[model samples]
Each structure stands twice: as C-alpha cells, then as structure tokens.
Target chain A: MRKAYSSLESLRGLCGLRICLAGSRPFKREVNSVKSRAKRLGLNSLTFPRRMYLFAAPALALFLVFWVFPLIQMFFYSFTNFNGINFNYDFVGLKNFVNIFKDGTLGNSIRNTLVYTIVMVGASNLLGLAIALALNSNIRLKTLFRTCCYIPALFSAIVVGFIWSYVYMPRSGLLVSLITLVGGDASKLNILGNHKVALYGIALVEVWKGFGSTMIIYLAGLQTLDENLLEAARIDGCNEWQLMRLVKLPLISATITINVILSAIGGLKAFDYAFIMTSGGPGKATNTLMFNVYRIAFNEQLMGKASALSVISFFCIIIVTVLMLYVMNKREVEL
Target chain B: MRKFRLKPQSVLLHAFLLCFCVLIIYPLLIVLSSSLRPPGNMDSPLLLFNQFSFASYIRAFEKMQYPKALLNSILTSGASVLVIVLFSSMAAYPVSRIKSKTSRFLYYFFIAGLIVPSQMVVVPVAQMIGRLSIPNNRFTPMIMFITCSLPFSTFLYAGFMKSVPVEIEESAYIDGAGLWTRFAWFVLPLLKPATVSVAITQGMWIWNDYFYPMIFVTRRDQFSIPVVMLQFLGDRENPAQWNILFAACVLCALPLIAVFAVMQKQFVTGIAAGAVKG
Candidate 1:
C-alpha cells in the first residue's frame, strides 16, 4: 500500500512538471509567434478572446452546474443512503447496490428493460431497412409516402403514448373494433392490461413510432452506396435477394450499428411512454429501469437507491455502446 | 412477353410495401376518424363510418384550454430555438476560427454534453432552480430548453462553420470589418441552412418535450401543450374523455406535422447532411 501511494505521488509530480513546462518560456515564444500571425491575418491573439469566452460562459456554466455537477453528485449519492429530503446520510459502502441485487422489482425492471431494448431495436431497424428498401424502388409519390410515414416520429412521446392509449382502450378502441369486425374475440385483447403481452405491446408501439426516423437514416446510407456494385452483381446473375444481402447490407453496416445503438439507448432511458401509458403497468409488467428510478425517487422518495439504479443503467448503456463500437470497428477493419 | 418474369416479383414487392404503408397509416387514420366521431357515438362498434361531428373538438378546446397552451408552447419553443441558435453560433465561431489546442479541447468538452442523459440531472437541476428562487414559470423551462439544446447546436454550427471557406471571412477582415460585423454579416448568413435545420430539429424536440415542463411548471396556465394533454389524460377528476383527448392530440400534433410535410425535402436532406458531416 505504501509503494502504491508513492507511485501515485510520483505520477502527480510528473503531471505538475508537465504543467510547469506548459507555462515556461518556450510556450511564451510560441504564443508570441501565433499572436504576430494573428495580427497579420487581422485575427485575435492565440489566447481566446475574453469577450468570446464571456459569451460562451452561460452555456459552459449551465452545463457544469446543471449537467456535470448533478451527475457527479448522483454518483456520490449512489454510494450513500441520502433520501430525498435532509441530504444527510452515511456512506454504507455498497449496501444500496447489494440491496438492488436482491431486489426482485429491480431484477424484473432490468429484464423488462433488456427485453424492450432488444425487441424495439431489432424490430425498428428491421422494419426501417425494409421500408427503406421498398421506398428505394421506383415508386411514384415516394416523397409523400416518406413524409407521411415519418410524421409519427415528430410527435412527442407523451402525445404518442396518449394516442396509443386511446387506440388500445378496451371498450371502443379502433383496434378492438377492428378485431371484432374480423370475428376475433376483442374482449380478451386488452393489450395494456395483460401481463404477458403488455411489455411486447409497449415495444410494438415504440417500434411503430420510431421506425420512420431509422428508415430515413437507412435511406441516407442507401444513397451513399455505389450503383455500380448493384449493377455488377446483377450482371453476374445474382438474384435480388442475393444482391442485397451481399452488396447493400455490407455497405450500410455502419448505419445499422448506429441505428441499433440509438434505439437501445432510447429504450433504456424510456420513461414518458411508460409513465403515460401503463405507469409501469399491472404488476410491473412494463416497468423499465428509468420508470422504476422515477417511481423510487419521486413517488417513494428513495433518492439514493434511485441514483444507484440510474448509475447501473448508465453503465449498462456504456457497455452496449462499447459493444456497438467494437462491432463497427471490427467490420471496418475486416473490410 | 420477353421481360414478363420481373413483373411478378415487382408486383409482390409493391404488395408488401402497400400493406406496410397501410399498417403504418392505420393508427393515425384511427385517431383522425375517432376525433371526428360524435361524442355520444364513440362507444358504437361501427363508428368508423359514422357521421362526423366537431363536438369533441369544441369540448377538447374548452376543457384543455388548448389555445393558451399552444401559445405557451410556441413562445417557449420559438424563444429557445432563437436563443440556442444565436448563442451556439456565436460560441461556435471562435471555436471553429481558432486552431489552438485549447479551443479544440473546449469543442470536445461541448460535444461530450450530448452523451450525458438530461434525465439523470433532473433532481439536482430542479433543486437548484428551486434554491435559486426562480419561480416555476414558462421562462424557467425555456431556459432549460436552451441550455440542453446548446451543445448539439454548437457542435453542428462548428462543423458547418469549418466547411465555410475562411476566404470569405478573410475578405471581410481585409475590408476592415470588425469581428462582430464579420460574424453577423458574413458567417451568419452563410449558416442559414444549418440554422434552419437546427431550428427544426431542436424546435420539434422542445415543443414536444413533456418531462421538463411537467416537472418545472406548476401552474396550469403555464403548462405547455404536451403537458396539458398528458394532464388531461392522467387527471382523475375528469378521466380523459377519449374522444376529446384524441381531438386535442390531433390539434397539438397538426402544426409540427404541417411543418414537416411542407419541409420534407429540406428536413430529410438536412438530417442526412448532418449525419454524414458528424
């Protein structure tokens, strides 16, 4: 332990030396040259303009106070037992985290969150790719169709939830009525009520609402592909399926990865829909990590535990992001 | 007859596309149809083709007090977009203009803001706002909107500003134009396309945002449209009249949908450009 401490002290000393070097005469000479060049070019000195920094001050200050500080405090609080009020608490050292491990609701929330992420991300990207491909064809009013499809994505999550709620209402919902018209038993189809189907129902709504944005992204990726490759494949007697599978998919691999990561992060942080639609539902069926955090923090006033959950969720998101980057980089290197 | 073989596959593709389009359009059509349905006839199974009425629209307008909420949303979101665009562009100018290590460090720090989820900071921000004695008002939420939007807008503006040939600014400098003047006349005008795209993207987000306003603004009169609609649905006293709620939703969504439809080409092009540039 003493040796480790000495090593850390040496590292700090090295950092201090570097800082001294940065502030030494050689740096001043470099600054003088840069300033002279700036004068010749009718520009400000190399040192950032005081007024410009002042103008940028509000943004930087707000981010630090509101974003950075809160995140740091949240990390600290996660290790403690500070409830919502009277921010005085002891650091119990992983007790809260240990509690989470044994907590069934949290386990369920994690499961639900993962399930939602996989299904929503998978379905949205698949549907989006399909839509992009279909729209890529020689169709009339293509622009109109694309715009129409993307309209739902512009609606706020709250509004989308409300609209879907009305659509899923058991009594007079459009969906229920349609089911009845087809001679299917509509009474048993309370999508938001059934435990088994509620999570999937929410995932379906999310996919429906989000697919258009992903489709547009894929469409952009498609535009970047070389038409010559497709022609060559066709000339080589490749069928449409084989041509797309071999040529188009590989070309747009990066975009698919991006879409998947975006969708996954979106799923993990999802709150508005679950809050508005099911409020974490009949027996925590649709209770995701974010929803549980909100409930625990706001409703139950368990701030420390909630922060711990959020930190866990944040780590989960990072892991997924790293995995995505790894996969994308591997693909790039292989190509 | 020589090329008839491709016709079958093409027809099959079209059939699949058409079915998917219908599926996508179904819920929206439902909302439109339901909003138009007379209030008393909502329970009927055959309500799809029922004669339409504006009764629910009228009632929703009255109950939700939508006009005031719409005004609030427009004012807040518009002001946010204006402030974010103006300030972010001003800040991005120097960052992009200077090629120093410090400036690059600051630029990366600004972009890092995008990855941190805003929801994670809600607790402390709320506490800070409360502690600072800033009353729960529309302006508070508007400020929050601008603050959250700054990083992305700045990143976008900086990226675009780099592509802008420095020659334009050099000529302005040679003309003895001051820094502010150069930015105002030369840089700002050239940034119009980026500005419009930023406005649309961030404006749509702020206008549709429910969480910030729901948590910050307490007064019903100060509530934005999305929060108001959410309250109407979640309120227990008058549990959201479904038809009326759908009518209000349709109204709330119409402006954005109209803007998107009209600017569909620019919207898609801008997003594609932004993604590629990023």
Candidate 2:
C-alpha cells in the first residue's frame, strides 16, 4: 500500500510539471500572436484599442452621467420656464433669451462684465509680469516677496471680500484713515461708493487676488527661456530693457497667452468679490453677468431667464476660449 | 566704463512692488487687528494701537457657534477631499492606462467639466437634490462638492499618471496581481505627489466654498464656516459690529492660511507642474 501511494504521488508530480510546461508554451505562443498582430496594426490598432476602451469605461461612464447629462439639462432648462420648485414648467421658447436682451439690468451687467474683464485681466497680467521680471533679476528677498504676494491668492474670495469691505469702510477703514492722516477728507472718499470707481475698485481687488497666479506662470515661462540668447544680446550692448522687450517677451509668449485666456475667463465669471462686497450694488455699478445670473435665479426667482443668461455666458466663454486658442496657436513659436 | 548708477526705472520698479505688497498685506493686517480689538473700541480710527483684546473672539465664537461650525467644516472638507481623491484617482487611472480613441474622448469629456461654471449647474443640481429627496444636510453638500471637484482632480491625476512608466504595472500583472491590486499597491503610491496636489487644491476649495453649502444645505447645523460667516454678516438688524465679524473671519481663514503657508512651495510647484503638463 505504501509503495502504491509513492508511485501515485510521483505520477501526480510529473503530471503537474507537464501541465505547467504546456501552459507556458501556450502563453508564450499567445504573447507572440499578440505582438505580431500589434505589429501588423499600428499602435492604436483595433484589438489593442478594444482593451483600452474596456479599461477606460469607468471614467467615460462618470463623465456621461455627471458632466454631459447636467450640461444637456442646463440647455433644456434654459428653453423652458422652469422656476426650479416645480420641474414641469412650460417651454417658453425664446422668451427667456428675449427677456435678457431687453432687460436693462442684463445689458448693464454685460457691460459691467466686459469692463471688469478688461481691467482685471489687463492689470493683473501686466503687474504679474512686472513682479516676475523683478524676481527674475538680482532682487533681494525674492522668496519672501513671492510668499507675501502669493498669500492673498490662497484666501477664499469671501474672506478677501470681507477683509476689503472693512478696509474700505467709510468711517474707520484703513484707506479712510490713511487719507485722513494725509489731511484729506476721508469721509467723502468711500472707494466702493462712487459708481464710476466702484467697478474699478472691485477690479483692483480681483487683480490683487489673482496676480500671484499669473506671476507664477510667467516665472515658469521665464525659466524655460534660453540664457544664451540673453547673453548674446548683452554682448551686443543691448541694455536690460531691450533684452526684455526683444528676447524675454517673445520667448514667454505661450505663458502670456495662457495667462490672458485664464484671466479673461475668470473676469467674465467674476462673482464672489463683487457679490459679497457690493452685492452688485451702488447702482449696480459692479454687477457682472454672472452676478446678475445669481441674483435673477436665487433672489428674483427668474429661473428661466437666469438659465438663459448662463447659456449666453457659456457661449461667450466658448467663443473667447476658441479665439484665444486660435490666436495662441497662430503665434506659437517652434522652439 | 562708467560707474553703475541707480536708474530711476529700478527705483520706480521697487516702489511699485512695495506698493503692491502693501496693498496685498493691508487688508489682512486690518482683519487680524480688528479681530483682536475689543468690540466697544472697534469704531476707533486707529486700529493698530487700539487696546488689543480677545473679547471679540469670544463673542464671535459664541454668536456664530464657531466651535460647531469649525468642526462641521473640518469634517465636511475632510470627507469631501477623501471622496474626490479616491474616486477621481480610480477613475483617472484607467483612463490614463488606456490608449483607445474612446479613452481619449472620455479624457476630453472629463476636462470639459472644467469650463462649465459651477453656477451654471446650480439650479439643476439644486432641483435634482430636492427631487431625489436627498437630505438637505452636510452630507448632501459633500456629495455635490465631490462631484464638482472631481473634474479638476481627475484631470490632474490623469496628467500625472501619464508620466508613470508602464513597466512597473506590467511586472505586477505578470506576477499574478489583478488590476485592483496593481493599482492599490503600485499606481497609488506612484501617484503621491499628484494626489497631494489634488488633495490640497480640492481640500482648500471644498473647505472655502460658500455657494454650494449656501444653495444645498438649508439647516443651520449643516452650515460650513463660509455660510455661517455670511449669516453672521446678514444678522444686521442691529448696527453690525465689525470686530466680531472680523474675529469670525480670522478664525475661518486661519486654518487654511496656516496650511497653505507651510505647503506653499509644494502647492506652487504642483500647480505649475500640472499646468505645464496639461
């Protein structure tokens, strides 16, 4: 009985080795077949592509459910007079769009948005470029200055607004105190009060909060520039200003394009500071298209009109983004 | 060879930068000073020298129920960041590894979310929340926050993941590791820097977001710090006391500011890297 059991165990061991060898051969064969197939079909061939799609299914599913569906719903809701409380409102075709076009508030808001975008984007990038240039030079305390400047960008817009609100307070705010200290009548100089200046005030705060980001982008771009070109210009007796204008600016064009595009989008969607500081107030001097949309939807319950405005804003963003891409692509340097 | 002279341009550049720095720091200094000042003396013109006190802090804490609000904000932000990081990384990993046209399309589809402003979807999202009978509470806001943050986090992770060499993954696959194990053991650790970036950015955003909590969570218990601060701002039938508001604002912003200051280098590096790569 013991001999028979030993022989059976040996036989089982041999069978296992044989099976392993056979399986290894088929696996190798299968791998070779795949390699040959892949070689025949290019990198993104059908069989390999099928495998990739299978892997990517989860991300695709999430995009469809969360992003695409909601966007479509937003579009559909814009067409209908849905007040959000009841989802069954009638489809008021073109009425919502017409209302926005005719509404004086909407027109004012659009104008305000454009003005805000121009001032904020323009000032922020220019200031950012200046700061970047300074840091790139042999400036002392570069790290400290960068930290201090960038700190404001980290704060929430609400917090920044609240802080600025106090600073701009007509009575005891810092700005008022500074003016008073200089023998000026501080009480009449409410920075956020003058209609003509309110938008600019808001834009200034926005630029203050945003310039750090643009500076960082510019710094990164500056780092990528070829030092040899700058040295060559220096040897040719081109001064610092000329080198900056002729060499640095053209080299960092991509970063400038990106900063402009991003800041433009941020400007059009400017809501938080304006909303919290003025609530688009002082005669709606600081009301942006987005701020108006928020007021219309939540405060006034003009859901359809608000959605229509959002669609307008959406299309505006798309157009601007496309324009930016076109302009940036056209100017892209091959280096 | 002339001795180098200080150019007017250099002096002016320094002056402008100094002015810019002052403009940036003044508001923050004011808020900090006001938060520390006694409530009764808040209307004084000289905030810097007014007898500094912490009475406003105590009052703001009591009035805003700030302890509760702080706890709520921390918990919600924590959970939201975890959800965003985990789900987004998981979803992004597959997309990054995959090389099909559909996968590329899916990648663009996710990025498209970045362009759609959160305000655009507020009405529909709010309606959906109501219709689904999702409890109008912190959890609900958390879910929405996760959804909104998913796009950016996924985009960051996918971009980072593209740089990871596939050989490590292939070796694991050959060693009998399944897809889940390969990701958990190999891919996740490799994705630490990107994960940290996504976490910090999304964490700060979710913690600081006002609109989501305002629109979704109706109850007081569910109010995040920003919402609570807004409520405090609005509770102004009486003459609004600036000291207490400033005190609350300080408390609300301090944690994030502290974290950001400590990690500013990493934060800046991560964002710059992500932007360049993307």
* lDDT (Cα, tens digit) per residue for candidate 1, span A96-178: 88888787766888899899988998899998898898888776567767876787888888778877886787766768888
Give fnat of each prediction, in order: 0.40, 0.38
Q: How many Å off is the CA of B103 in candidate 1? A: 3.4
TM-score of A-chain in each prediction? 0.81, 0.83
State the lDDT of candidate 2 residue by residue for A1-335, as single tens digits: 99999999999999999998889988999998996787567655421233434444554554555556667788888898888677679999999999888867667887898899999988999989989998887665678778778888777778788777766777667788888888888788788888988999999889988898788878878888888989999999998889999888888887888788778878888889778899888988988888888888889887888889988888877787788779887886667
| Candidate 1: stretches off by over 4 Å | A1-55, A87-91, A333-335, B1-6, B45-49, B234-240
**All-Cα superposition RMSD per candidate:** 11.1, 11.5
Strongest candidate by DockQ: 1
Fill in the DockQ of model 1. Answer: 0.40
Error of 1 at A162 (Å): 1.9
Ten consecutive residues with minimal summed lDDT in candidate 2 chain B?
B231-240
